[model samples]
Target: MTTSIEPGPSRYSFDNDDPESVGRHSHLSNILDPFTFQRLGTLGDLAGKRCLEVGAGGGSVARWFAEQAGPTGDVLATDLNVRHIPLDAGFRVLRHDLVAEPVPDGPWDVIHARLVLLHIPQREAVLARLAESLAPGGALVIEEWATEFGNLCLAAPDDEAAGLIDEYRDTLVNRVLPGRGNDPAWAARVHATMLANGLVGVDTAIDAASWPGGSPGALLIAVNVAQLHDDFIAAGFTEERIQRLYAAVQDPRLVVRSHFTYSTIGRRPGGS
Candidate 1:
């Protein structure tokens, strides 16, 4: 038998030689802090456990987890684009796509996917696969963004540009991205999904905060918005409008807050 498969979007590629791909920028740490370390701490000790970090971008979080797991434990960090994973003695990196390929066999003590589900359209199916990989009494931790248009404020020089920025962001987040609007309810949905997939003891914890001023969180927001200017212009926004929006993002008065939610620790039944 023969099969034909259409190519997916080129979101992840091996060409991670860009300087931005390797840096230890505080901006990323700030944006990921609420979901990553803070929530992971709630999962208790990880030493001597087998852990898997899906979508381990740049392997930063995986590296941190490796430290927590220590020499007695093992960590496997996998990404669609594994080229960005730096050499590490404690962890193994593999290139895997949850949607198209089978997840590696795991009776893992913990399976983690942070800020990753939103990018995959078949989230429920992926959740089922993750559940199958969990060991008895193992945990699955997930974190995703909740982006609402009215919830975000722009600090542009004028109202018109600010509105355009909001529109562009909304369109990209809702239409271009794989998931629906990043709502807080997404946590509940994910928790329910895991429960339906036969996981036991499903629960969620939500964290919300604003990125203000020149903080790293604010800077990450600025950088992502700036990078999307061209896409906004291509989507019918004028160059003048794009520049105006950029300026607005730099305004000190504008506060951009994202609702971050984590649905963590869906344990497998029976502790098999």
Candidate 2:
């Protein structure tokens, strides 16, 4: 017999007294910035449509969606953990787990999730839930990182450090995060998953962009590397090895290439 675990309270409810530490640790804002404008563009017009944003970390995307929907439209943002949400007139932030909480009643014109599904082990189940919440003709958008984007390189002369970074990368792509195991093929799989679950007019688009040379990109990459380095050390890698990896990553000659994929705009069968 399969045992079902009761869903716990919202995963996003952080302590009000610890906002500073929480904000510093929250990488969702930086990690999500690159795709914000692009995601909005992909969403098309939503001048007066109800919208749901799942995993609206820090309310960045939620704010954007609220702006697009205007006062006439409503945007409900939900996440397992409630951090800092900017005060906005029409935006409503809720502490709810998409898997457990009933999706707010929606014949929503649009629903979107970005960089959110990678952490979810139950991708198919979540997609099914999102699909069911849609009104006929409603659009569902999902974007995820492809495993192929896990490229990290260091110009350091120390081969040992490079090796360690590689190992950490493997862990990050395969184990550290729950469903990131399917990173490379996540978009394609999601496409099929949605269709299989009864969505129609499915379409997918892959976005590939380079970080090139910029402090913003460099800083973000360095922070991510540092996080991975800490994880590696915790997982038995030596401190020296982690240091060496960071050194190589900081080298000017090493160019890191990341490729991201997105599957946007699947529709519920029948017109709303």
lDDT of 2 at 62: 76
lDDT of 1 by residue, 1-272 (tens): 11122323335321233344443234665567656787788778999888998987666788888889988888888776666665554687777787788887778888998767765667778888998888888889887766533546535445764575576566556543323323333555787888888888787777767755455655554455445445545556567765655565556665666555554668888764
Q: Candidate 1, residue 8: CA error in Å?
A: 13
Model 1 residue 83 CA deviation in Å: 2.9
How many pairs collide in each candidate, listed in order?
A: 3, 8
12-33 per-residue lDDT for model 2 (tens digits): 2222234342443354455455
What TM value does model 2 have?
Answer: 0.77
lDDT score for residue 122 of model 2: 67
Model 2 backbone overlap count: 8
lDDT of 2: 0.63
